[model samples]
Every structure is written in C-alpha cells, then in structure tokens.
Target: MLVSSIGASIVQTVGGAVKIHDMSWVTGSGKTMSALLLVPDGASADDKRPAIVLAHGWWNNKQMQDSNYVELARRGYVVLSIDMYGHASSDPLQEGHEMDAATGMYDGVKEIASLPYVDTTRIGISGHSNGARAANFAIPIDDKAATPLISSVYLVDNDPIYTDETGKYVNYYGDRDVGVQADQYDEFFFRSYDANGVALTAPRDYIGTPNAQSFLHFGADPSGQAARKPYTTYTQSVDGRDAVREIDNPAQTHPWGPFSKQEVTSLLTYFDKTLGAPTAIAPGSQIWQLKEGFNALGLVGFGMFLIAFATSLLGTRAFAGLRAGPAPALVPREGRGLLWFWGSLVVSAIVSGVSYWIISANTAVGTVSFLGDPPINPQGAVWIIALWAALNGLVAIVIMTVSYRVVGRRTGVSLRDIGVLPGWRRFWQGILLGAIVVASAFLIVFVLAYFFTTDFRLWVIAIPTFTPNKLAIAGIYLPFFLLYFLANSVAINSFNRFAIRGREWGNTAVLALANGIAPIILVIAQYSHFFITGELISGFGGINSIWLFPIVVILPVAAVVTRKIYRATGNPYIGGFIMACVVTIVSVSNTLTYTR
Candidate 1:
C-alpha cells in the first residue's frame, strides 16, 4: 500500500518471468515493515535460490540499490532491497525521525529471509556507507529470533571484515591510503569504523599494477591526483596468487552499487568466489588486511600532555588581567597588610588541597581500573596538582581584591564613628557563603540525578559501581556553573554603573535578555542531538528539552521585575540579591523536578 507514482518503476522491474513483489513483515516489536522482492524467471513453488539483501546507506532511498538488485538478480539470485525507517517510503519513528542503521539492517535481513524464493540457508547481505555498517551488525543475529536474517555478508568497497560471537564476517570498505584527491573518501570510511573500535587499513596486496591503480578514475590522469600510491603498503606476507586473484578494478571510488560493466563483473566474481564458491583462507591473513596503523600508548600520552600544556598557558593568560595593582593614596585603608592576603592564600590552599585529594581518590577508584594501570605518571601528576593550586590562588586573589575595594570605600572612617566593629565575622561570612553555594549546587544536582533517571543507576550503580569518574564529572560541572554565575553577577553590577536613562530598568533588562538568550540557543543545540544521534545532552535525562525555553523567558522577566522593585526602594543591592535568590530557586527546582 505504498501509494506513489514511483511505484510504477517497481512494477516495471516486476514484469516478465521474474516476478517482483512488495510485502510487509513485522519486527520483534511487532512494527509492520515493507520491502521489494525479486524472484527469477520460471520460479517453481519449491524453488530455492541464494538471495542477497541490499541495504541503503545514510540519507538514501531503497532505489539506490536498484543497480545492485539488477546485477544480483541477473546472476540468478533472488534480491531484496529495503527502504530503512525514516527514509523514502518508510514510517517515521520519533520526533527527530532518525533511524538506527544497525536496527534497520537486522530487521531488513530478517524480512528478506522469510521470502518464499529465498534460500534461508544461503542468505547474503550488502550495504553502502552507513548501510555497510548495518550489514555488518545484521549478520550475526540468531535468525530464529528476528527479521532481516543474514547468513553471509558482501561489503563492496567496504574495508576488512570481523567475526561476531557467531563467527560471521563484518566487511568494511575505505580508501587503502587517503590523499588530497581522496580526502572525503577517507572521512566516509573513518566515520563507519572508528567509533566502533575498528580502524581502516590499506589494501596491501592490492597496491600497484593496472588492476589496482592509484587514480580514483581510469579516465583521470594519475599525475593530477595526489602523488602517493593508491593502496597501503604492508610488510606482512601474503600469497602471490591470493594477491593477484583478489584484486578488483581500481576505477571505483567507494561506490556501493554496481556502477559499470567492469564493476558488476568484479562483484559477481568476488561473491561467486567468496560466498558462492567458498574458499578457505587463514583467519590471521584477513585480520592483517584490516589494520593500517598501530596503537601506541606513548604517542597517546604525548598528545594528551601537549593539549594540557596548551590549556594551562591559556588559563594563565586569561586571569593575568585580574592581578592586583597599587591602590590610590587618597583612601585611608587597612594598609594592605601581608598577613590578611597571606591568610586568605593559606585558607584557599587548604580548600584546594582537600578538593584535589577527593578528586584523586575518586580517579584512583574509577578511571584507573579501566585504564589498565593508574595514570600516576610523576610529571602529569605534578602538572595537575600545580594547575589546581594556581586556580585556587587566583580565587584568593579575587577575594583580596574585593576586600581592598571595601577598605577604599571606608577610607578615613573610624570603626567607632562608622558604628561598626572590626572582627572575623565578615571575613568568615564571605568564606562560608562561598563554600555553601559551591557545595549546595553540587549536592543538589547529584541528588536530582540519582532520584530522577535510570542513567545514574546504570552508569554508576550497575556497571563500574562506585566509580569516582562520575563524581569528578559532576563536581567539575557544578562548580563551573557556580563560578559562571558569580562572574556574571560581577559583570552585570559593573555594567549597571553606566546606565542613566531609566538606569535600573535598562541594566536589568539587558542582563536578563543576555542570560535568557544564551541558554535558549544552547537548548536548541541540545535538542538537535536527537535528530543526529540518540544521545541527549549529558546529565539530567534530557531535561533541557522541557525546561530551557521556559527558564530563558522567565529569567529576563524576573530581572525586569526586580529592577522595578529596586527603583521604587532606591536599593540596587536589594534588587541584585533578589535576582540571585530567584535564579537559585529556579535552578534547584528544575534539577529536582527533572531528576524525579
């Protein structure tokens, strides 16, 4: 019942002795599915033929497999090409309409295998690009368990194959050696394999000679393309006969379907030799063909070190402008005592030390186990500790700066005349407030995540139970948010000074608009993830989708309301304090509700 003018072509392909039919099947979840089936001429009721199922790649329609279907059909095999979910002629799944390639491939194979003309025992699967990866995922599923049942796999221009627990081939394809002219070809292959822990390798045995030319197309001059050879060079020993016989035509550039007379012949030969007329080759020989490079721990460590070094340099320069300068002489102040600054430094250092100790303990218990060995290299450990200490010292400097400004404000005003007492009360209050705000935000988010989503249970409580990495990630994010709020508050306060015409209202409106707009953009970006991948934004179970827009709108309105209150009372600090309180409450409430 796929009603469309395009259905005419499928009808045309169906005409003659080869009866083409369209049918729907159900998946594991009982979702109805559709596919195009091709049966050869003069097929009998008991006739069984080796069948090949073709899966279309990312953003592609089932018609893309037309050439492949025709070729396979011409070779006397019943061929089926399926339209994946969310693509042409397929039903949409979710809001984003994105389909998982692996799931589609598995189901497609199962549906095709149930066909009357298809020899269930000799099913072969093929896909291009994302479909190629899907075909790889489909081959090992228990046929008795689901749809798109696969027996063997044939990956065209796809790279090496791997075996699943059931020992079926997962063939991959890519450029043997990517060069300037072949840049996009490399990206296409890398995207399919890298995320799944597979690496693209050069076709070592296929390199050199007319059968495996370096140029992408035979008509294109070889000199116009990158100077490097087309195929990867391998030192591993492979049989001479195997090398020459396995080599395919060099004109194709990662094309999945049949492109020309030469390509169709090559594909038929490959399938006939590999899948039809089976051959026995050493497993190790095939494995060697899949690898292009070695994974070295030393190289990885060096790369990380370089990145960390760059980060440190950038962090230092960012805070350099905040360095203290000489105070103006007109202010009669507490004479810039070293003891006051040094005491603040000592307290900050202690707090930072405790935080580091906690983080290190968590890292040791969590990340270390997965890393094989503890990341306790002396040099790296020193750098991490030093950076944390430096950041804490910067915080202390900020506190001292605020104190200096207060001292300047109270210049020449004696304690008795000012009706104030010089004591540790103010100092301790600031310190306690900073700590409470920092700690509360972290605790609130943690509790919310624990109560609300199964994510915490799955990631933390189930697998890698008691991992410190979870704590570290949460801790960093929470404190970072707090710092961002504080910095924003300071900036807004300074900006308010320049307002003259409806100063309070103007300043408040500006701050509210800026804050609201920033978070709105971020929320939109987060939602886009569903269309691209199933992954949501980190933490809070994709709660941003529900709350971000409302909060963005509310915050600005609250800012405006607070500005009016401040103007009526002639107390700007009161306005600022109220704004801060409202924001805090909203944040906490959002976290709690989202988590639940």
Candidate 2:
C-alpha cells in the first residue's frame, strides 16, 4: 500500500480507542516544532498513564515512529513522536538543529506530563539515528539547568562516543554502524559537563542518575544471520553465571524493525519490564544477553587464520618471482638502504603507539592509566594491553610489507638485500621525521580545536596549554599523518611513473578518473554511515555540514595539479611538498574563517 494511504488508514482502523493528534510547540529558542501524539482510547484526564516521546532518524519523519506508537498504545501507554528541527512538520532552524529539537522534545514531554491523565513520574524518551543522538544529549543535561526536564532514555542503533587505544570508538559495533559509537553518548555527556561545569554534568554521571534509567538497544539481525555471525552466539559471565544470548531475529537492521507483531511483543515486554508495568518483561536485559555471545578467542583465531592464509598466498613463488624480473635495475637508483626501511618501520610503530595514547588522553573521557595506578580489573587490563600490543605488531608487519613493496620495486632490490642503517643516521632521521609528524599533527589539532572549543582565542595564536594528554594526542596524530603522507606520495609517484609510459591521453584520463573518483568515495563513506545509523562524525554534521565538502572537492583538484607538476618537474618530492602546502593553506584558511 502507498505510505500516505497507510498512514491515514492506521488511526482509523484503530478507531476511537486511540486519538492521534498533530501539534506544534515553540522551543525556548523561539523555534516552532511539530509532533504527533497518540492518546489511548478513553484516556481520561485522571487516567495518569505513562508516556513515551519518540525522535525520528535522519531523513525520516514522525510517521516512522507510528509503528512504535501503535504498539505502545496497544500496551496501554501514550506515545508521542516528533519531527526534529528541519524535518517533517518542524521548521528549518540551523545546522545541528537536532540538538535544539531534542530540547523541544523535552519541552513537549513536559507538556504531556502536565496533562492530568499522563503520569508525570513515569516518563521515558526514545530515539533512532540523529534522534538517538539528540536523546542521548538531552538525558544528561542537569535537571535544573536549561529545560529542567528528565526522563528515562532509550537509544536505538546509535553509537555513543568513547574511544579505545586505536582511536576507534569502544563498542561491540564500533565501526559497524559508521556514525554512532557506544562511547559517544558518554563523551558528549562528559564534555557538556566540562563546558557547563558541575551544575550540568554532576547529576547525570551514572546509569540511574536523576532517578531515571537509560538503556541502549542495537538491532542485531540484518541480512538474516549474515550480519549476526561471530557476534551472533556466545557466552558471558554475568552476575557470576555463565549465560548465553543468541540473536534469532533475521529481519532487524540498524534500527529496530517496525512494530510488527513480533517487534510489538518484544518492545512491550521491554517497556513493561523497565517502565513499571505489572508483568515484568526481560527485554531490557537483551544487551547483557547479547554480550554473552561474543567469543573473543574465536574472533582472534579466525583473524589469525585469515592472516596465515593471506601470507601464504602472497609468499607463493609465482607472485614473488614475477615482480623480481624488472626489479634489479631499479634498486641502486631508487632504493633506501635496508637499514633505513627497518628503522623507519620501528619508528613508525613507536609513533603510532604514542599517537594513540595522546588522542585517547586529550578526549573528554581522559587517558587510560596503565602503570601509575592498579587497574580496576587487572586480568581484563592485561588482556586489553596484550591485544593492543599484538595489534601494533600487526600494524608494524603491514607497514614493513608496504615499505618493501615501494622501496623494493623502486630501488630494484629484493627484500632480502635490504640492510640496516648506521646508528647515527637512523637516530637523526627518526627524530626529524618524528618532529615533522608531531608538528603537522599539532597544526591539525590546533585548527580543529579552534573550531570546536569555545576557548579558541586562548590557543589559536598563543602557545597551547599542553597537558600530558594533549601532548600524547599530538604524538599520535603526528606520526600517523607523516606515514600517511609518505605512503600517499610514494604511491602516486610510482603510479605516475607507470602512467607516464602510456599515451598522454591515457595518462591524463587515468589521473582524472582517480582524482575525480577519490572524493566521491570518501563522501560516500562519510555519509553512508548516517543511512546505516543516524549519527554523523563529531564536529561534522554529515552531508548537511557541507563546510567540509569544498575541502573534499579541492583535494582532488589539488591531486591533479600536483600530478601535473610532478610530470613537469620529474621530482615527486617537489610535487608532494607543493600539494601539501596547498592543502595546509586551504585547511588553515578554512579553520580561521569558520572558527572565528
């Protein structure tokens, strides 16, 4: 059936038992917002039923919440789903209006609670996608501050902001959803506290803060069991009991599936359990239940097996010998000594570890202390540290393989012919590269901080306030950026050399294609996360945050320009420097303009 027709008929089919009303309210900021409210059949002014407020995902409207509304109302609860700012019936406000919409949602909830039949004491809020993020932000605000409202929260399929050592968000589905992280909500809550002081942050520090509970539900089944593999079944020790939670649903995606019969049953069960209904449902316990399914050993073993298989394939005689045919002649001219390669690899690994530590420290969650204090759980700590070390080692191996491919091919030397650099040169070069990397990272951080922090003036031109954490973050970003730049330059240089041997049109065509396609790929990767789940990168508000779009576009143009310059100069180094400068200038200018 057509969507419009389906919507119109839904309420009618439910009859006068439920009253659906569309309403608008003005926010504290003077923005008018629109919402849909469902009042159960014969809900008297004195009925005092629990109410749920819903927030929709990106590019979606209140109708998306209709399924949940029907289910909740059938369970004898009132539900309200609002169109966030700039969406559906709500007026367009500004960029990041989702934040404002969240405030407005609280206001509406307050209005709902005041109605005689609605139980003010038993209120809850739930959101999906961007809505989910807004809900997270709303719940942690001090009950006495700003809107002065509080409610239990349900975040669906959204990542909260928090980071692991690798600069990845710490969650079961860290990169799985692209947009939201499990730790993000916590980070935002903490940062908001830091910015607003104790008045805003202190009250909402824990799970049951302000007499309200917050819960998260990430849909487990997508693409049938295909998306559920590895994470599908496992065992966990919960409350001293080894329990298993298997994900049996085959239809759910990033967000919970619409309130189908099964979904309604599950959701009602969860709400009844969490919201003080008579029959206790164990729905909210699913998160813990699901965690039982994660088999760390199995995951690691599978990864190792894959690595072994790949290494075996790459080491095969046919592949190894094929590249050797034209390699010898190039070795003497293009090769860095074997020592240089090995030293560089070691330095890169050190830089990576330092950078990870630094970024983790600077963020709102602060640094993880390994040595200074005893860990809360020494055993878990040991495992995590070991995993990090192993990952870093893996990274070093990958870097070595990459270095071998580039240096070996260019210099016409086999990996076996590489030698160690002298101690002095190795030391100095490592220091120099490390310094350059650190400086570059600082520049990026300063630029980003200027735009993000309210106290931009303090650090924009003056010497930055360097805490151990800030320094650590700088250390991390610097080397990673350097290695990234070096790899990019080398790859382009090699590719250009290959292309130069082709016809002029073919070379230009290939360059143009690559330059044109790269940004498109990046943009797609950046925005696709929103469709999968309703969160965007912090600071960047997704495609709607179009401030970075120009920069993305300029990068391809700059690449083309640099390629041309390289061909003309026959010096890849010069071309790389010029491109780097261009990018830096663009970045700085954008930062200054936007931040100010």
Highest-TM-score candidate: 2
Worst 10 residues of 2 by lDDT: 453-462
Tell me the RMSD of model 1 versus the true structure: 20.4
Estimate the lDDT of model 1: 0.39
lDDT of 2 by residue, 1-596 (tens): 12222333343225445676667777656866767777776567766688878876654456555556655665567778776664444554343344553635665666676677777666777666566676655653424355434434545445344434553333232111111212212212212233335324321232222211111123221222322221132333434533332222223333333323344444455456445552233433222111111222222222233223322332455322211122222222223544444355345436544433433334232222111121222111122222333344355446556665766566663333322221444334333332343345345434532332111111011112122322322232233323333333433443333323434545444444443343354446545653444344443322222222443444344445444433432333333443343333222221100000
lDDT, residue 12, model 2: 26
- Candidate 1 lDDT over residue span 65-126, tens digit each: 55556556645678777766534334323322233435366666666566676677666677
Angstrom error of the Cα, residue 340, model 1: value is 70
